[model samples]
Target: MNRLFPVWRRCAAVWVTGGLAAVLSVHAYAQAPTQRPAQSATQSPTAWTTSWSTALQEIPRIAEPPPLYQAPAVAGRTVRQIIVPTLSGTTTQLRISNRYGTRPLTIAGVTVARSAAGAAIEPGSASVVTFGGKREVVLGPGMEMDSDAIPFKVTRGAPLTVSVDAGSDAVMQAWHRIAGRVSYVSSEGRHAGDIPAAAFNVRFTQYAWITRLAVSGEHKGGLVAIGDSITDGLRSTFGADRSWPSELSRRLAAAGATPMAILNTGISGNRLLSGSVCYGDSLESRFEHDAAELPGVHTVVVMIGINDINFSSMPARRGLDCDTPHKVVSADDLIAGYRRVIATAHRHGLHIVGGTITPAALPPAREAIRLKVNEWIRDGRAFDGVVDFDKALRDPAHPDRLKTSFDSGDHVHPSDAGYAAMALAAEGVVPGAKR
Candidate 1:
């Protein structure tokens, strides 16, 4: 070890030989890490790969839904286009319904487009949608259909133009009151031999009914609209997309936002804390199924509670419940119930926007409770945000009643125009969710 070598020879051995060995080791390991075990095609025939094309082919095909009821004389119209607000550059789904029609209906030529000035006939550059088998469809009475998938590049709250063409003088059954994705369908097609929109696949052994139209793209989460009959659009004409939620959905699309999927959980007699007159679950009891169960839900708009006060005080409906002549619920009880619902939603990180109970003085007692509860709801005691439906809809002269201009003949629910106003009130908070 002590023997001295020629100075230049010693230096060359230490620097050049050691550096070359280190470099060779590193290069060998890098190549080794990338090397994979090759399979023999003769032995395996097919080798598994992580490529996207192989994964797509391996996925199972989704079967269609079932057929609904049908009659001879009546029929529903065809949905031509559906435009919805979505997260800009996101994809979404569209739902078509005949839930209220009396007979079977045929559907053909479904498309999407940007909202135009007057012509509801032309397909615009913004339009792109496809049907099953790229062919026309037929919906049975009281049934629905979900079209083949579509990709939407939604801007923040852009206006999506939707239209339909009736094959005959057929009336389409849709969500008459509320704007949502759920709708009814008919039982049979236009004729026995017509291409059925709702069919059962023999190969897959599943119903081929298109109950939901889902559009998924680069958008963010969606919207869940919860409320009563006014939000439901009870007095609006059938097949007319005039409900407040529908209008709100349209407005959301116009803003270049993700098209919000409206899950209409509004029951005619739904209450805030108590049972309903229509024999369904109360708002409190039904919350789990209606609001919590919706897919892709990011926000909830709650505009209910008037029915709790109205139906409880109705003398004609008194005998249906308990021995007490009436069930008068206090504001405290309603607030407590709301707190529970809010807590549950917050656990899931959902933003809840509360809507004040609408003005309802027709029965007098109902009006008093509405005012009391709305005061608490507006006081920032319950929800994440407040939409003052009462102030927007209340009459200037008669503060206790709905505005005469906005009231339907019944005075309880808002007319189509009034619903539009409510839609505007919650527009800023309800429809716009950040990406």
Candidate 2:
């Protein structure tokens, strides 16, 4: 068995093999730390901030509508009642994206307030959100804009309502489907300051336009969970924050463990090596933007590649050209992808934790491949740490399938109880986390 080298040694090897230019390129792509202006003696010290991202999803370019609508494409409307559960902060800011837009997106108005009830804001808690002191901002195609900090006390686990008036110019909005919460929308008007759900007639189960919520507070760093639909909380309950990452955050807070904001960057049907129109970019392609560049992110827990394996043996479907039918990948191919991610994380000084692929109800051939991959993850020493999700969710009797009680009926995704178990398995992998 090949022993894992120390992180420092691995970093040195990467520098020697790839050269300084390659190292610099990876670091730049990951947006590694740079020099910041020194604070003046008269000015107060900079406050620590943690960015908690509501993972972004790609709007599928489908020719036919699916059986159920996961998210609605809205234009010329005011999304008035977006409830986001936060961790800790004294002040808050928002990150909005037009990543997939073909034209400029205009924001007519924006506001943030504490939620009083369903679609209702606390009286006197409404605050106008501005961009660089401007009431409105225009974002071009494939662009993202961050709002100026709004002075608000954000209590842990409290929901904050963020309202935005996407003017008529805002078309084909990028949204995060499977919000697991309800958000209300208005009919082509600026009602961002509205306190009641009266004006907001339509309710949606996904978050629109907004991608990230950052808060200024003291924290050790941020934790990013990157993977596929399982990590995305697909089968999890709607309107309830029960994803393993969310549960893990609650556990950390309850235990008074390390102060780290958890950011879930999972997308349904996402793969490690390939991209699809509906599933967003591949892990390799979006890691920098989705996980690395985020503010104060120091660790990433990755659980990808299952789709890569499962989809390989499936028949090709329309709009999913990335997953070619009968294209089975060897364990080596998957391990190569993991190594690339690990190296990139190491170069950026972020600890990468590898997650063993959980067992699925696959044929013997595919199951064998999964076992190979998990074995490599356990003994490969490529990652800083390993979370044995396979062990956590697998049945002792079958050993190649999810436990009956833990299975979410699909034999792939985990039940709510299983998700909690997965979170527990990952409890102490986070740096500075108390056992």
Judged by lDDT, which candidate is best? 2
Clash number for candidate 2:
1
RMSD of each: 20.4, 7.7
lDDT of 2 at 401: 88
Residue 122 of model 1, lDDT score: 29
* Least well predicted 10-residue stretch by lDDT in candidate 2: 12-21
- Summarize candidate 2's per-residue lDDT along 1-435 as a digit string, tens digits: 000112232211111111121121222223344222211112223343445676566665556646343455456778854554445777777777877777888988888898977888888998888777887888877777767767877776788888888877566545777677788887667788877777787887777778777777666667899999889887877777888898888888888875678878888778898876667778887887777666667778899989888887777766435455335687889999888888777766776788889888889888888989988887666676778888889999998889988888899998888889888877756665666
Candidate no. 2 TM-score? 0.87
lDDT for each residue of candidate 1 in 176-263, tens digit (9 for 90 to 100)? 2223232223232322121222421111111112223233432344556665666666776544656677777666656666445654
lDDT of each: 0.48, 0.72
Question: Worst ten-residue run, lDDT, model 1?
Answer: 49-58
